[model samples]
Target chain A: MDRLSVPTSRPLTRLIEALNRMPGIGPKMAQRLAYYLLRASAEEAQTLAEAIVAVKEEAVLCAICQNTADTSPCTLCQDPTRDRSLICVVEEPLDVLALERSGAFKGLYHVLHGCISPIDGVGPEDLKVRELLARIHDGEVQEVIMATNPNLEGEATSMYVQRLLSPLGVKVSRLARGLPFGGDVEYADEVTLSRALQDRHSL
Target chain B: MLGGTRLGEADRLVTLYTQRRGKVRAVVRGALRPRSRLGGHIQPLSHCQLMLTESKGLDVVTGCQIIGPLFPMREDLVHHARGFYLMELIDCFCPEGLENPALFSLLVDTLEHLCLGEGGERVLRRFEVRLLDITGFRPELHCCLGCQQALEPVTNYLSPSAGGLLCRACAPEQSPVHSVSVNTVKVLRLLREADMETVNRLNLAPDLAAELEAALRSYIQYVLERSIKSGVWLERLRREFGPNGALGGPQNGR
Candidate 1:
């Protein structure tokens, strides 16, 4: 049977199509979601729709850091208690959240939104690199922590940014790599093991 | 794997240029998770042996073992950018499931050479010429496109649109022809025939190197009908971090 020709209400089909367009949501899952929404109370469905709309409407990129936030500078950037001398550069806003949840470092965050992916047609200019440079022009920041993911694109993005930041005379550091806590050293990749050994310190 | 993208929340969609099958896309289950074993082994530009099972859409990677991580290339920014450029070329030209082991070998060998910190400019030019040849787009460097006469040891025009060299007589016929010197032609021809070892022995004068770079990039851009994204970044890196008073001094002697 032609899947598109299945007898269904137009609105339900539209909902399914919209859901299907989302990443990781296949046709069957979209249909399931649409049907579930149909069975739910009208108020519940309206609330869900309103929440999605509200997120799109309310979320704005922070002017200072380019992170998605409700305000221009973002609460984190405006927080006086946070260390203004330290900046943690991350690939995504979620990473900022992850680092914030850790509570180990009190630093401002700069989200590049994406990494330098050549295959994906993303380059340094495509990212918010110029904005990052502009932020450091005043020389308030002392050190920049490269907290990009431990992947090739992420590392390349970090290096590209680091090259730009070199002339600014700010101390740059990369996140440490080693075996995760409770992970066996035997299973670690050679690169990780090598980095672990190199970064090893006294007990 | 040439590169990969995050899939869903925990998995990864990877593109691998295989020795037997050419370009293949497969899913690495839970590859985004911190402790996923496949995550580290399936990095871009890393040589790996993968166990893939047939699936409905893309293949599923069930097992993987690292062969060469090309770690040294990652240690230097220029080397890493060059590696990405090579991978981008392969990804652009080679179609999926078109088994050409020779092309695959060329990629692996060039990557290995880059990782070993060999002369980058010559190696890249050699790779481009050889890639064009393997993919059946080799330009006619020896003969003129219009008159079919053997090229002379003098100033010539390289018509990217014509996909070859044109003698002074034939130059005006092509829409856009880059002024290529005889030395550039000789070096390009040498790169076409020479092994990686021979290429290592070769050095390019700055002007001649620039001419060759321009001519080849124009040809490649013409062929693809679009510019390679990495090429732009490579140029930027060279400008900012290249030999002339850049962050790193005298990179790869290019």
Candidate 2:
């Protein structure tokens, strides 16, 4: 606790505590990080600070896909080079990284940011699902890939999205098995994610 | 812990999942009272018919009757650790509001198998494989990730990172690979294809058992995204039993 008791700003203390709670980073690491930031040159520190601030200020939720982006239409949504017909829906921004790392998906993406959980009082309305439907309402998309994490919430979210999208007559596919069991999109290798994307079957 | 909380008493935490609701924590009122029937049924890893009183945010458990208690799970450390592993995985993997009969049945059957004397290892392996399938992380056991051709039973590398077998045709492309045997592939297939009851009946040799353990560990590492405390404890448990690994004496059917 003493190491964590930084005689600095309240915001710094709070960030340290929050970072400490994150998996893999211990209190010491959190404190070191906090102290390093405090000691860092103003211009260098501003780069990190500005990036964090810009995440909220510059990034707007893509009106169509709901992924955070500088533009209302995210790069994925805007990209004409990618498969406009295929939409890979995921739970969070990190999931986008996971898919991208796999070098497999060459399509648009929708970030739900969360899954439905009655226990947690998180309903479909809590997610960016309406925007997803709005995209489908345009009637050009051919396939919807439900790449929510392979966990309960992820499955439930995908199922909900699938049921919603199915009524619209668009093909809804799920990632085929090949990703590690219970593995998240973030950790999956390029090979596995690519294969899973290729083997995706209609739900 | 047995769940119950009222204005007069302290909070009691109980993990719950119902057909109507998914996984959640609720408190019961007066469950600890000596006269309370709720205490009789509300125990860890016990199957029960519970009536939930839907509250404003968190629900309350009004009543419950013991459907079955996984008594054998607690009797031994290996079974206990395994049971905890299943419960934690189910708790973490399953989200709230989703009624997956598949996951529920898998949990119940796997617990039942763990209680039974025969083939605990096989039952657990089968459960892990199926749990992944039901959720969506189905391993590509049939072929290599790159070439798309079928890999011979033992000719592929089991890469957790790559998500499945890396056939020799495509192995050079994938750098990190785990050496996998034909027996391992067959056992994994048996798990994927067989029902829980059939899976519980298979007799596993030491080598097969070790292979299964390795495969499952990596698979879990891939999916769970984080480590479970019980997993670390399980390693210690097996070491305590013997260097050969988690085998109980004749009575527990290690």
Q: Find the candidate with the highest DockQ and give its number.
A: 1
C-alpha lDDT (0 to 100) for residue B2 of candidate 2: 16
The digit string of per-residue lDDT tens for model 1 on B1-254 reads: 88777788899999999998999999999888778777877888788888999999899999887887788877777777788889899989988889999899999899898877676777899999999999999999999999999988999999988989999999998979998999999998998999988987887888988899899999999999899888887787777666553214443665
- Report model 1's interface C-alpha RMSD after superposition on the true interface residues: 1.4
The TM-score of predicted model 2 comes to 0.52
Q: Per-prediction DockQ, in order?
A: 0.63, 0.01
TM-score (C-alpha, index-matched) for candidate 1? 0.95
Clash count per candidate: 0, 10
Residues A97-135 of candidate 2: C-alpha lDDT, one tens digit per residue: 889998988998889888754334466778888889998
Q: Rate the local accuracy (lDDT) of all candidates.
A: 0.86, 0.70
lDDT of 2 by residue, B54-122 (tens): 797867778775566665664454665666667667776787668887778778877887787556666
